[model samples]
Target chain A: MRRLCVHTITTKPLSLEECLVEFPKRGVSGITIWRQALEGRDLGAVARQTREAGLDVVSLCRGGFFPAATATGRQAAIDDNLKAIEQAHAIGAPLIVLVCGAVPGQPLVESRKQITDGIAAVLPAAEKAGVKLAIEPLHPMYADDRSAVNTMRQAHEICDALGSPKSVGIAVDVYHVWWDPELKEQIDHAGKTGRLHAFHICDWRTPTIDLLNDRGLMGEGCINIREISDWVDATGFTGHREVEIFSNRLWSGDQREFLEKIAASYAQLYA
Target chain B: MRRLCVHTITTKPLSLEECLVEFPKRGVSGITIWRQALEGRDLGAVARQTREAGLDVVSLCRGGFFPAATATGRQAAIDDNLKAIEQAHAIGAPLIVLVCGAVPGQPLVESRKQITDGIAAVLPAAEKAGVKLAIEPLHPMYADDRSAVNTMRQAHEICDALGSPKSVGIAVDVYHVWWDPELKEQIDHAGKTGRLHAFHICDWRTPTIDLLNDRGLMGEGCINIREISDWVDATGFTGHREVEIFSNRLWSGDQREFLEKIAASYAQLYA
Candidate 1:
């Protein structure tokens, strides 16, 4: 139960205040705050509140959209990521998961180059703030507009290009990487290189209706979550298994029940 | 115009007879027949009609759903594939494009083993019929049920496992592999090994609405069709560039207009 964490986006309907009150009640010991949840709130107070509520601030939800067409666009993305680093620092969060961006029609190779440069631009700020950045490789379906970093190998390549910075690592999300034939080998390598920063749990539904928001809950779909979880643990990763789902179906229901189901699912998954 | 081939599924509204009439009218030189399009029809008559209509029968649309949960299911799949081989032989199609298969929740490693074994079982029949088999690696998005083979590298690995048989080769589909980083290297290797048997073309729509039925036409989405075509051609692949799309949007429209557009798209793309 203490290792159970949930992203704010999982319970999309809950306000930050509501989340602080509700998450711990449902046995969620950690919370990864989405940037939207921090709007108009005092970061220090939110940090204090999270501590008082007996919940660890796991990490900031996202911070990378580094690839763009123009220099101005790239600079703007860097500025946003810099701001994210500061925000993570303010909120007492130690990490930020990156959903690196891609231009729809741009060559992916070019986009990846821009991503590498953009991360280089942001690394100094992240290092100063003592906040790590976890590059979460999106599924290939998002290779057009959402991300060009669509595999752990690509993420590792970027990390290598950046001189293997200590502040930069990867977040392994099963939804994006479970289909990879080289998943176990890549995960093992990431663990060895100290590049494995975070772990996320979700399932891939068979008849996935929507590409973006049709993620299945833990036991609701066909993913070998337990096996993947075992691999992550085998790497000596004693971190929280963040429940980060982007599901239209689950978000439309009662969030309280959703949280309840998440608690039960985590219990069964780890048991 | 000589290399422009279209799968019958691309224009789903057209019947086999209709395809025989409409394809040559639009300057399409070849046709790949989907098995469903030949349902309850005489294969010999269909072959005669296609040839007399001045269109080459490029390949049978599919055969290979090699993964199943049980021995009975696996044998059924193999039996069905054998039937597809006979149909291809009868129809004068020199090849069969395999979609392969995966069982939900089955380890992909296990599914891949089944696929390799199933292909091995059917290879003698395919060779005896003088029909080549092209392994079409489906996108990882379809890894749940469509195929465990999701990259050119994996397809090559399977071929290598089967003792690198001449009858078994790979079909390179841009839609399934455009995002792959190792695509160029894999294509180059396949060409050198004489395993680059077929090439497929289609665009990948940005906001892909449906997984199974929302493929984009050439120039309709973000895929670099020309670039991938260049790579295939660089491999000395003089095979027909099969236009294989599965779009509900195009299927619901006037297929004559769709064919006109396909012709225009191909001209603009290759020009």
Candidate 2:
């Protein structure tokens, strides 16, 4: 079955409660809530409402951004990630998505080492809390200031070094990895290794305005989402296809209308 | 010894003859002329003036855009590349930079294969004309409408398969490959293989507005231009770091002022 997951970023203007209500109303199978939306709200109440509404918590928004200029900053990030793990566990979320951080005032090699160390520091806490950590490899464009883990091969190598298939895996986001020449091969490798943890869907707009926002809706851009989804499905992982678009245009639209468009887009491709 | 090369796109508003005259006045060591500027100009006169002005024609930009839906379109592209090779030879340029085409009407995979095949088809003419075909792997943002060849590894693989080290190589643009995870490794590989042909320099703005025209001037954006140039230099591949920014802001400025800015920017970084 093609399970649909609503990433809260698609309807970021709405509150977590509003997003939760909107998801079920739009016929989404699950919801992936961002940590930002959970801010200033009762965590237990939001979690309870999600459960009461019978919405499947696919995965938590994120918990990685590890690279930091100072030791204090690094430690603070780790502490924050620990809290994120606890939040995921509280909400009955299966995985805590990690956007492994990038070059901090040091060379890339040193930054990569720090990323690994940061992940290792949080592994034990996440393990104890029964939360799977999904390391999301962002597009290489974000390697400088965003995430250093920019390739599946690199992420898999990190997982291998850690020596725990259950503790660490990867989230395959098409927006980030669609342009990779080795994407298909890496996806196959991830599938064979059972390291494919989450699936993300979005498009690369032709005239991308902003590096952070300006992401296209699934079918609006050139990425063949259906082909990539088929590859993910071939991995024998039937997880939800989370619509994780960070588009300013979409965000400004009516929340209900946006949800309806997402459903329509998903149906056009996956259904 | 460091050399100076003016990318014609810098003076895109000027006529080709006017552009040629500007290079000598600016005290530039060489010029990299684009095909668009050469479209209706007299090739013989342009070539003659290039020599008369004592300008070393470093490279010709460009001749690839190979992905097309029809066989006739592909053939037309091949013929056009042949003409470009002739033009490069006439102008005394050592390299004809090939922006290997993108997906015609299909997904990236199919487009990538066409790009490789297109290059393979054109290599003989390039070799015959004594013109080295430098495959400029554009940023992945261009993988859809511009160039499917989006990585150094992919470009190197095509060069390797073609089996003529002198006939095919790559033009490393900082704006394109600055974000690559395996950039250093690929640069080293290109160096070892004698495939580092031409080096183009530009910066990627954080909030890139237009996919094509929003490139930042060096030192303005997040790209570590010095580090990337150091890698290129380490390869023992002695080539001019050609300034190739496509900026609306710069283009709209006074032509002489724009030239002065580029010269100053180059001096700060390279001199």
Q: lDDT per residue, candidate 2, B1-271, as tens digits?
A: 2477888887778776776777767778788999887787777778888888888889999999888887898889888988888998877788999888875237777777777788888788788889998888888777778888888988887787777467788999988988777789999999988899988887766656666887877777878888989999999977787889888977887887777777788788876
Give each model's whole-structure lDDT: 0.94, 0.83
lDDT of 1 by residue, B1-271 (tens): 9999999999988898999999999999999999999999999999899989999899997998899999999999999999999999999999999999999999999999999999999999999999999999999999999999999999999999999999999999999999999999999999999999889999999889888889999999999899989999998989898999999999999999999999999999999
Q: What TM-score does prediction 2 earn?
A: 0.93
DockQ of each: 0.82, 0.42
Model 2: fraction of the reference interface contacts it also forms: 0.30
Give model 1's TM-score versus the native structure.
0.99
lDDT (Cα, 0-100) at B77 in candidate 2: 86
Comparing to the true complex, what docking class would candidate 1 get? high
* Candidate topping TM-score: 1
lDDT: worst 10-residue window of model 2 chain A: A102-111
Q: Give per-residue lDDT, candidate 1, residue B104.
A: 92
